[model samples]
Target: MKYRIIELSVLIIAVISVYAGLSYARQAAGGQTIQKGGLVADVRAKKIGDIVTILINENARASNNNATQTNKQNQLEATGDFGNSFLNNLSGGVSAQTQNQYRGSGQVSTSGTFTMQITASIIKVKEDGNFIIRGSREVETNGEKVVTVVEGVIRPGDISRDNTISSSKIADARIFHQGTGVSTQAHRPGLFTRILNWIF
Candidate 1:
């Protein structure tokens, strides 16, 4: 009975030691994460309100062409026979004809590209371990002010060690850029053009 008790104790201790070694090995393989910030260099963003740098590179292109044509024609003719009478000179033959034609064509093409960077805040943590982030930026150059805003959802796995994520990895992204001042007005249509467009 004494030997059996001793063997059981030895088995339990060996099992516990093996489990501890495995736990340590796993931690070493994955590296350690410092949960505390401020004094330590913890760059990963894990919670709401944490900021992360976002790199944006997006582009768009579109083109369209259309044409229409229509044509219509109608003709009517009448002839009468008269012998040795003045009516023969005036009513010998009568003819009428009508024709209509229309043709129209149009073409349009547009393309644009945007590349920038902004610091975004984590707004929400999804149930599936995704993050909803929003960011905005404004820049002014020689009395021209441009504002940019971005919002999207990103997976934690896509974030780099420096807490930066590329725009391509983001899903359901909304990006807007607008400018004001002389440069903006220069690109806008003149009053005459606007009036013509409205009338048409």
Candidate 2:
């Protein structure tokens, strides 16, 4: 019985020594642990607010023993700017043209009465490349309610293989109104003018 107890004690000590040695070796080899708060560094040339692209690499072998390191890449894009003048004008302000390019994509999803001011322009690009746009705008209004807004996602497969209606056009104007209501002067001519036309 004493021999068995002695053997059990030696086995326990050996296992504990092995565990401590492994832990010490790992620390000496720069085994950095990735915690929940571990954030990758930002390595982008241009950045605006929360919209940023980070270039990063992985080193899982350092913390995970015998694990092959696998690098992962993620692309993130976010925008806060609602469509400005271009959209307002596109719907109907000057020329009238209907194209699905900028139809009902983005939104401002706000629940309040406020005036919005903005500037806008259209851009064309090829199929292959890293392209992104981020903007934000706001107006003075009462924010008594919480609102959640989302822009329509445009995927690569969503585009048409055959390019049609590639260009954009202006919108139209509203009806002619002289005062509070629509002006009926042109439709119903003055009595004097009617008499003059009959006499002529």
Candidate 3:
């Protein structure tokens, strides 16, 4: 009976100590005070730009049996809806015509994850009544993915009477070819050169 009494007393003391410690912690936390081991931390966040991706399947067709066929199929397996929104915004309000030029008859897939960093500049008007847009976009796509950037000057005033421009009038054209940790700048056009590109 005496041993039982001693054990009961010890248990009561332990419970009372735990209750006291909990009460003290609650008061300290309410005031955002530092307690025995560590203090509560206040976190801050900053605003920054984002990179996004999207899955796009264009020129889709299905037979009566419902087997799907498409000219291009690109899937983006990234977290968040940022990728979808980015592609939608760039595609211009879900209209078909805006994204048509970028499409091709054969399958041109751009799947996989890519980190895109973009910076753009524009010259509103040229002396020859033409506008110039200079954009620098860095896209890290596939392992062997490469992009050849071209810079050229054109004279709109030199058009012939038939309203057709001559190709020989290209005074200066520079190309910056980049791929696989290798970069080269040359006056000649690279293998992936879209010679005639216009937006009206």
Report the number of the highest-lDDT candidate. 1
Rank the models by lDDT, top first: 1, 3, 2
For candidate 3, the lDDT comes to: 0.38
Each model's TM-score, in the order given? 0.47, 0.19, 0.21
Q: Model 2 has how many clashing residue pairs?
A: 3
Give the count of colliding residue pairs in each prediction.
0, 3, 1
What would the per-residue lDDT of candidate 3 be over residues 1-200, giving only the tens digit for each residue? 99999999999999999999999999978666554323223211111121111111123332221122223323333333345565545533332321112322222324343333223233344565542423344446543445544334444454333333332343353334355422112222333433222221
In order, what is each prediction's RMSD in angstroms?
A: 17.7, 30.4, 31.4
lDDT of 2 by residue, 8-58 (tens): 999999999999999998886654544322433322222222232111111
Worst 10 residues of 1 by lDDT: 30-39
User: lDDT of all predictions, in order shown?
Assistant: 0.79, 0.31, 0.38
lDDT of candidate 1 over 1-200, digit per residue (tens): 99999999999999999999999998876564433443366477889999999998879675645565555666777678766666568754766776655555554444797678999999999999999999999998877777888899999999988889999998999887666766445545557655544543
Deviating ranges (above 4 Å) for candidate 1: 1-40, 60-113, 183-200
Candidate 1 TM-score over all chains jointly: 0.47
